[model samples]
Target: MPVSLVILAAGQGTRMNSDLPKVLHQVAAAPLLHHAMQAGLSLDPEKLVVVTGHGAEAVAKAARAYDARCDTVMQAEQLGTGHAVAQAMPLLAGMAGDCFVLYGDTPFIRPETLEAMLAARARHAVVVLGFEARDPGRYGRLIAEGEALQRIVEFKDATDEERAITLCNSGVICADTAVLADLVSAIGNSNAAGEYYLTDIVEIARKRGLSAGVVICDEAETLGVNTRAQLAEAEAAFQARARAEALDNGVTLTAPETVFFALDTHVGRDAIIGPNVIFGPGVTIESGAEILAFCHLTGCHVSRGATVGPFARLRPGAELAEDVHVGNFVEIKNAILDEGVKVGHLTYLGDADVGEHTNIGAGTVTCNYDGVNKHRTKIGKRAFIGSDTMLVAPVTVGDGAMTGSGSVITENVPAEAVALGRAKQVTKPGLAPKLFDMYKAAKAKRQKDQA
Candidate 1:
């Protein structure tokens, strides 16, 4: 059956004590909404809707940024979960297939868990995701007989026997689109909290003789972020899982705990990541590439056999081809280094392209920006850039060209040519001794006069 996703992101998360929407807060260098959307995307749902309320604009922007096809609807009021899901009904009007309700603050729901919920739909009309919480702790209780769920009772409304049930509702549910709409519309806010509870759907479904089922998942998979401490815990959990997955996929981490990965970071098998290496979004390290300790990389690609710094930064648009060596203290931004290019210590290459086999000496810089605008520097194959050479922007060094150390290259150099743009040296004999004696005598005279 076709599937649709309705993600709830309208919670103000007042417990978080921040102006930023709870869904916009990041774990693993990505917004929590992204993680939720990523899990939903795995289902390839035909329609995706995000119900927004608190900080709706910001939440909508983040949702669209992660998936442009995502549709966002505003709840307008801080109603209950049932009201939140009701807001998405208009978007799903006449849409066939099942609708899976997800929570934005819950980022750890596994794709497999959702698949299990879908499998349960074959036997029941309503399926609710549940977990055996280590401590039920005020969570809604799922009254069930084996896999057959009878009803859900909020901790506040639950009787002593119901409260004793260890099975807790995760607030995630799956049902046919039309059935969900009807049940949500029939819901009333006459409970203890006077709020429409999505959990009521289970009892209502059972009243109509439609089967209600429960799909149990790990307790960790239902971890929800509500405050700063929980956010920190979520980050730690994400990192632990990412590290374990990398190890299982044949990537080598010299210090696994010291390495952090972003949501979209991809390191191929055989890639070696050293300690304290932080990866930001949009990074890909091909197989056999080595990223040394203390390196920060974002929006870059490192091809096979490339080795990056023990203390280097690769900014957005940086691309290192096969066998490229970018050594310590080097920073590359918006540049591409072809195969066999060596850019050793203390260099900054930005908005430039270096051809194959080029040797960039220490302290070399591509002066790409001129206060107002940015320009590009192009260095051809086999070119030699001497130490301390500054290639001013809008310049090119042809193939096999060599520049003298301390050169300020503002113009192009032809192939096979040696360019030297420095002031000629002129020496004056005995000038240093004479100047020193004059200065010392003057100093003595001044001291005597002062005395």
Candidate 2:
């Protein structure tokens, strides 16, 4: 059977205390809502609908970034879960397959858990994701009869015994599209909150003689971020899972807890990651690559056997070929370092192409931008860039060419040529003491004048 997904992102999240929408806040270097969307993408749903309310435009934009095929609906009012989901009804109208409802604020949901819910739909009309919470507290209780879920009772409305139930509703529900639409339509605002609750659909299904089921998942999978503190907690949880996964996949992490990974970071087996490394979006480390401590990489690829710094930054468009060495305090952006290239510490290589086996010395810089225009620098194979050399943009260093130390190169250097851009050396002998005596006489005359 085909499946679709409806993501609810209509909450105000006033507790977050920021102008940005709550769902837009990042966990593991990605928007929380994006994480939810990624989990759903694994299922290859036919239709993905994101319902936005607070910060509607921004939230919708973020949603589309993850899945361009995503359709968005607006919930103009902050009513309740049922009302929020109903906003997507028009899009779900003609579909008869299973439709899963996910929360944008709850981003740790796993694909396997969603698959379990969809699987249970084969035997039940409604399937609700639940968790055995250590402290159920105010969460809605999931009343189950064997594998069948009898009802969902909110804590405030439940009796003492019901409230004690540890199997709590995680607010993730899946049902046939038509059944979900019908059940949500029938839910009324008759409770103390005067809001239509999606949980009511469970009892409504039971009343219609439709069997309901529950798929139990980890409580951590249902964590919702409503404040800064919760966001931090979510980030920590995401890191723990990502680190463990990296280790399980045969990658090495020197200090697992200190490293952070983005949503799309990919590290092949045998890659080594040091402590305090942060991977932003679109980073890939091939097998045998070593990334040292305190490095940050984003939108870059480290090829096999490449080594990156203890304090390097790889910005967007940076690519390191096999055996490339990018030392500490180096930053590479919009550049490609070919195989066997060695770039030592304290250098900036941007908008440049460095050929194979090129050795770039410390304090070297490719002046790529001038006022408004950005230019490129090409360093041919085996080229040597001396320390403190500034290779002005639109310049090229041919194969086997070398530049003198502290040289300011504004033009090309031919193949195998040595480019010396510094001024002629000159010295004045026996002048230091004479200059000091003159300075002392002047100082003495000035002091007498002042007295």
Candidate 3:
């Protein structure tokens, strides 16, 4: 059967203590709602509806960025979970498929677990995700008989015996679209919290003589982020899982705990990453690549056998071909370093293209941006850019050409030619002492006058 997802992102999350919406806060360099959408999208659902409340505009914008097909509805009031789900019914109307309700703050739900929940629908009319909480403290209890769930009792309302049950509701549920619509409409807010509870659907289904079951998952999968500390904890948990997966896939991390990865970081087998390397949004390392410590990379691609530095920054659009070497303190932006290209320390190569076997010496900078416009600097194969050389944009160095050290190149150099753009040296022998005498006398006269 086809499936649709209704994500509840209506909570204000006042505990987060930030101007940004809680779901919009980043974990692993992505919003929490985006993470939830990723898990639900794996099922290839027919429709996706995100219910937004606080900071709805920003939250909706982020949702569309991840899945352009995602539709959004607004929950003007924070009436509770059932009211949040009800706002999505108009969008899902006439859609004949199973609907899965998920929480935006809970992002670690695995695709396999969701698949199992859908499978459970074959035997039960409603399926709620349940977890065996180690400390069932204040969570809602899932009351069940055998494999069939009888009802869900909130901790405030549950009796002492019921509260002792370790099984808790995760607030994720799967049910037929038509059945869920009916159940949500029949719900009333008369409990201790005086809010419409999504869990009440279980009892409503039971009263109608329909069966409700549950799919069990690890407690970690239901972790909800509500504060800065909890967000950090979630990030740590995600990194642990990412590092373990990377190790199992044959990637080596010199110091795994010190390294942080973005949600979309991809490293091929045999890639080695050193300590304190932070990968931002779009990074890919091909097999045999080595990234040294303290390197930060984002939106860049490193090909086979490439070596990036101990203090390198590869910004968006930077591409390193096979056997390329980018050394310490070098920043590359919107540039391509071809195979066998060598860019050493203290260089900035932005909006430029270097051909195969080219050597970019220390302090070499491609002056790509003028006061008004940005341009490209092109260097051909085997060209040598000497130390402290500045290649002003709209300039090109032909194949096998060389530029003198400290040269400021403004025009093209022909193939196999040497370009020296510095002024001729002139020396006055034995003049150092006279110059020092003059300076000393001026300093003494100025001091005497002041006194």
Candidate 4:
């Protein structure tokens, strides 16, 4: 049977107090809603529907960044949970499989729990995924009798006894696709919140003699964010999990808590990550590579045995080959450094390629952007670019070539040749001191006349 996931992202999230949709807030370098989509993807749903409201345009834009062909369902009016799911019904018009509904704000939900619920789903309908909470004060109460659930009583409607019940609801359930469509239609928006809740279907199912099964999961897996504080907590949780995974993969982090990993970063075995490193998406570090403290890498690759900065920045399209050393204050973007390359202190190499065993000296900069367009600077093998040199692109330094310090190379240098382009040095002794004394003597004369 096919499975279609209906992700609810239509809520305005007033509690977040920001114009940007709460789902777009990042956790581990990706949006929270995108993380929820990953959980949905894990189940391999046949189709996906993202219901959008509030910032509909922005939400739809974010959906484009995720996998699966997403159809945006417009919830023009902020009615209720049932209404939000109802808007997605048109997207699932011809679908015959189970329709799995999930909240976008619930980013930490584990795929294992969803798989468990699917496994427990029955032939026609099954309202599953619940747990006995240690503190169920704010959650809806789950009233189960024997092997079946009686009803999930909302907190507002529940009496004192039901309110004290420890068995709480997770609000994540799967049912027959057609049966769910009909059940959602029957839910009326006559409750305290004036919103037609999907949870009402649980009680309606019990009344119709349909069995409501229960599948329990760790409560932590169901945590959702509604405010900035909650967002911070979610970020901390995600980072913690990411660090733990990196450690388990044979990557040694000096201070795991100080290291931040993106959701899709790949680290090879025996790689060492120093403290306070921030890894953005698409970053991959090969085995035996060492990244020193305060390094920020985004969409880049570090080859085996390569050593990156104590303070280096590697932007998108940056690739460092084996045994490459990018020392402190080196920023590389859209550049490739071949094996045994050493790009030492304070350099910027963007849209360029540095050859094998090349020594790029301190403060050397490849001025790639010439006001209007970006140009490439190519350096051949064993080339030596001297300290404080500026290669104004589009320029090339040939194999075994050497450049003098403080030189500004406008033209390409031939193989085995030396290039030096700088202002001629001249000395003027005593002139500087004579000028200073003249100014001081004038000031003294003026002060004496005034007295």
Candidate 1 lDDT over 124-186, as tens digits, reads 999999999999999999989999999999999989988888999999999999999999998
Q: What RMSD, rounded to one decimal, does every model reach?
A: 1.8, 2.0, 1.7, 2.6
Candidate 2, residues 56-110, lDDT tens digits: the string is 9999999988888999999999889999999999998898688999999999999
* Superposed Cα deviation of residue 163, candidate 1 (Å): 2.2
The global C-alpha lDDT for each of the candidates, from Candidate 1 onward, is 0.96, 0.95, 0.95, 0.88
- Residue 235 lDDT in candidate 4: 85
Q: Which residue pairs of candidate 2 clash?
A: none
The parts of candidate 4 lying over 4 Å away from their true place are: 122-124, 427-451
TM-score for each candidate, following the candidate numbering: 0.96, 0.96, 0.96, 0.92
Displacement of residue 220 (Cα, Å) in model 1 is 1.1
- Model 2 off-target regions past 4 Å? 433-451
Candidate 1 structure lDDT: 0.96
Consecutive 10-residue window with the lowest summed lDDT within model 1 = 75-84
Clashing pairs in 3: none
Candidate numbers, best lDDT first, in rank order: 1, 3, 2, 4
Model 3 residue 397 CA deviation in Å: 2.4
Q: State in Å the error of residue 84, model 2.
A: 1.0
